[model samples]
Target: MASVSVSFPKYMSHIPTRHAGHLAELCIVPRNLSLMKQGSVRELRIVRSSNQTEPLIDCTNKPSDIPLLSCSEATERLKQNREKHKGKQQFLAMYSSIYGGTVTDAAAMAIPMDDHMVHRGHGVFDTAATMNGYLYELEQHFDRIIRSASMAKIVLPFDRETIRRILLQTVSASKCIKGSLRYWISAGPGDFQLSPSGCNQPALYAIVIEDQSLFDSKGIKVVTSSIPIKPPQFATTKSVNYPPNVLSKMEAEEKGAYAAIWLDEDGFVAEGPNMNVAFVTKEKELLMPNFDKILSGCTAKRFLTLAEGLMTAGKLHGIRVDNVSVEEGKRADEMMLIGSGILVRPVVQ
Candidate 1:
């Protein structure tokens, strides 16, 4: 581990930033944030987080061996790389507030490297599902993203109505009827700094990703995550700070599970990495954990409303949102995960 002396406030010290010759390293700064004078500096060390001692790359290439390219040369290389790595899901269109337009070419759809969201994780995002030329629960998702942006302290790049229109136009331009529309609001491109104050302005980015596969109702295995859950303040916000989520998912995958489930500080069922968890109890109640400690999932909320019809049809006894214990959840007759991306997926184990 490498250490650096920082002169700024100590609160900003824990943020791990990229440094030379390593994936991540910790630098200490001040905690109580205040306006700093010139040369008030923070020290950073680019250190590896993992235990692996070997370098990621062999010592075969050097700075002198690299070839510098012009703008057009870089664009051509990006296009070639994109074409060579095409996958099942297609990126149809993207809207960037930075450029004030939509781009159909995947090579052209890129966010600035210095965007606070890119390096500092100062952003919030949400997604809408498109089906048969219509956006499902677009209003609700849009509202949630706005709330998330507010919670993340990222100002909207444009008014709500204008943003909505831009989203609609991006999806329309894509002509993708059976996919999802994802968008982000970031602190915008600026110098790489922990504070968003240096950002020139906020930015909005939207992309349409086309998925042609039919929905599968298959149940999947899940495991309790060893990774700790985030605090309620951060957990409830759909921000781009997803390192915990990513690690939890990786843990589940390592255990041959679909997704890892997190428990609250009190050991009550919280949620999956990216989706809401729901259970159908033996008594036929649609049971879900309260949203005060987890993300207020739009798809999960909509499903709760739709499930009301099932109660009317005598399929469910009632619906309840409360603290669900692990034993209680495990004993439930049916378990499922709900989210915009996965919709409703049954969990078998």
Candidate 2:
């Protein structure tokens, strides 16, 4: 392969030229990226000379601190970041240790998640938005975290306030500029007796992730799965018991669909792989699957609240849904799955 040249913006210091080809991975925001014509040759910019200037993210110079790094330079630096977990992190990722967490200090010998709790197979978790850079429902997520922990007997190291501070610290240390936050807490691992015990110091970690799924006007395609959604005793708690959801998604992927609708054991529409499934029929009625076995979603709550407001003001013209049958949802004109990762995804399967 031929060599590719790379360069940093005026603010960034001189980076070794060896990082050329890898500088092509830093992608632009979803919008700009999609505008570029596919299969077109992208030009790589190289600075022939260097002048001392502020770094892209660290330029404190009052004049202009924010440096705009070209695609290649950003990509190169990203490529050099080795994401290896040197200590207990490896164990956690391998399911040898707790696997419940938002971020793991792999370099530190800390288990941040519960990978083996029997209750984990049936627990739930949720993350809310951050207002003015502060988590809007940070408290709510914390509550759910503890709930999941209790159901799984996972010991969290920090309290609500302490956890909040930790969350801010991670975001300050992260590269995310904006958009929602996340939490990954699980029941502590335990024996096969279908009880949560014998697991100590369960992993409780959180972070902020890009909210890719928003009120995207574009609709989505979905493939309903034959697999049944099992009744999760700890459905209200956010735990890492994710096999059922994962498999439902796998079934969808097998059919080239964006997501799958999980049906209850009784063969009724339950929810989406990672969201609450909802539909509005042409008859002007809103329908949703029972939340008994579904993850209590924050985004879904917001959507419902908005729907209620619209209905109250006579701005909306449909029924606020509580539950719907799988057969009815399948027959609806539109279907959507709402969740943290994908806020509101419209589906056609």
Candidate 3:
């Protein structure tokens, strides 16, 4: 392979280059550099250059070198990157057992890369909504996470009361009156191996995200997902392994739908990608699929308990939790998806 001649300014000459084929490309390894394309050539601009200048070079190969960064430099770069994209949801606070405290800076809100949760997906998570400065059904959600961690064979980092207190304190620090709190329990940072035996300890992490959006009452459309449903054991646990769920959600959005519903191996209605399904029959009876093969959503269970009042008020004839066939669900008078995040969302299609 012939060497591709490329010239940079005196200050930028340190950047290494490489060659592939007739098609030329420039590969910059630093995250702080900005790429600008003009006509057929691309230019690299140093974001924090002392002279505040960009390099105009005719590049034909990718760079084999990567810049080694110090801990503070990397953290600053991450903070800069986050400043570029400000979304509607704001991360107000974070709590990490690894740090043994809480951090209000969004840049400091991160988990270790070696964590089993980040690598082998050996983690479980739960979410609670903050309503009017209070965590709604936090105890129920906390109980579910505990069950999930036990099923995943992850020991808690702290006792139940301790963890609960940490969660509340983290939320209070955020001062977010209305938002959501999400937390995770992982096997902690360890070697890149299949077994969690190398993990010295378990980890817990929590973050509070502020959402100003109101509860949307508009009904949405849904379709049957082509992705296979998770097995009963894994399905029931709210673990971090969610490739199937992610794919199902993407499949629905690709077809212009809000969400995709799943069916069990026996063809009974299972649940949505992340929510439970419930229906109101023509006889004014409330019906839902059994939780034997799917996750029992905290919000769905709470709704079922509260629905008894509707029965007493003559709004519902009865409530049943059994196998709901697809045909039966389709024939129902109304259908809704239930979960902590959504609370309850009606499905019009």
Candidate 4:
């Protein structure tokens, strides 16, 4: 078979850093069908532009007058391109794609366009962080994702042990001592239909992101969420349907607060947009909202387990999980938000 490889310029700087590389790959792939139709295999590569202000180049079509490039020429071009742009690349360090059971470079990673998660949001996702070469609470987060997948009616692509190995391998491949691992299990790629029955099996994707931002411990202000909270069924599932949560977060940012807190249907304290809330009561009690109507947070659960030592040491009188009314929470001596990302953040108001 004939082979053709093309280079694209850096048009990705304008896109948000998280999604720029993926979108750049998508934009380049569709326009190269003519070469493929000629029984030629094509590879599209992106390289940074020398002039920062100039619009980046994208390889689309080879002019008929120009001769087809040889394999060595293509390889050399890619090498030179990488050498020129290596310092500026902020793409994923590594990613695992379950469809092919392959771990790949982040720039070369792309999900199937027709996955149910892409079209209908039929998926579940969970994240764990790697700090100093250690994966924090990985098993706990994986269990939560499995529960979410069950709730979403999505079967896993691999057994739990295999998945755990793959995740650990993915992180090891990245060699990211301080980064976060985010993974998803989705109803696999199929026709873009509402029903996932047409899909053959589920898909898993994991990526290692190098985020160096330190978790802030300082107190932050939070506003009451105006967006309606999801019902207990959906709220507790941790599925991919997160429009309500997204809106709640945006509402908080728009109101000049760090995050917004949701209240259950009965006006009891529910959770932050994406975290579990806890309170330190005046009676030296540690209180968390009951998990019945909120997502059961692994970090919060671990905190509760460790806080038992506090009680034994006389630092706390008791620890209780119960329905906490908004008024009661507001009157607590201290309030905090807990999550994998934010280990603990005091809520000032």
Put down candidate 1 lDDT per residue, 2-56, tens digits, no spaces: 2333454345356454432232232222455332234333222333454434233
Where does the lowest 10-residue lDDT sum fall in candidate 4? 50-59
Instruction: Identify the candidate with maximal lDDT.
Output: 3
List the pairs of residues colliding in candidate 4: 9-57
Which segments of model 2 are wrong by more than 4 Å? 1-125, 129-136, 186-200, 210-216, 313-315
How close to the true structure is residue 120 of candidate 1, measured as C-alpha lDDT? 89
Better of 2 and 4 by TM-score: 4
> What digit string (tens of lDDT, one per residue) describes model 3 on residues 131-201?
89999999999999999999999999999999999999999999999899999999999888999999879
Q: For each candidate, give its TM-score against the true structure.
A: 0.83, 0.59, 0.82, 0.74
Which of the two candidates, 3 or 4, achieves a greater lDDT against the reference?
A: 3
TM-score of 4: 0.74
TM-score, predicted candidate 1 vs. hidden true structure: 0.83
**Which window of ten consecutive residues has the lowest lDDT sum in model 2?**
88-97
**Which candidate do you rate higher for TM-score, 1 or 4?**
1
Local accuracy of candidate 4 as per-residue lDDT tens digits, 1-349: 1333433445644657567555554445445345444543344334344322222333345655666888768656665765578642234544445445544444345677789998898989999988898899899999999999999889988899988998888888788788788899999988898999998778988888777776679999999999999999899887889999999999999998999999999999999989999999999899999999999999999999999999999999999999999888878999999998789999887
What is the C-alpha local distance difference test score of each model?
Answer: 0.88, 0.57, 0.89, 0.81
**Candidate 4, residue 138: CA error in Å?**
1.2
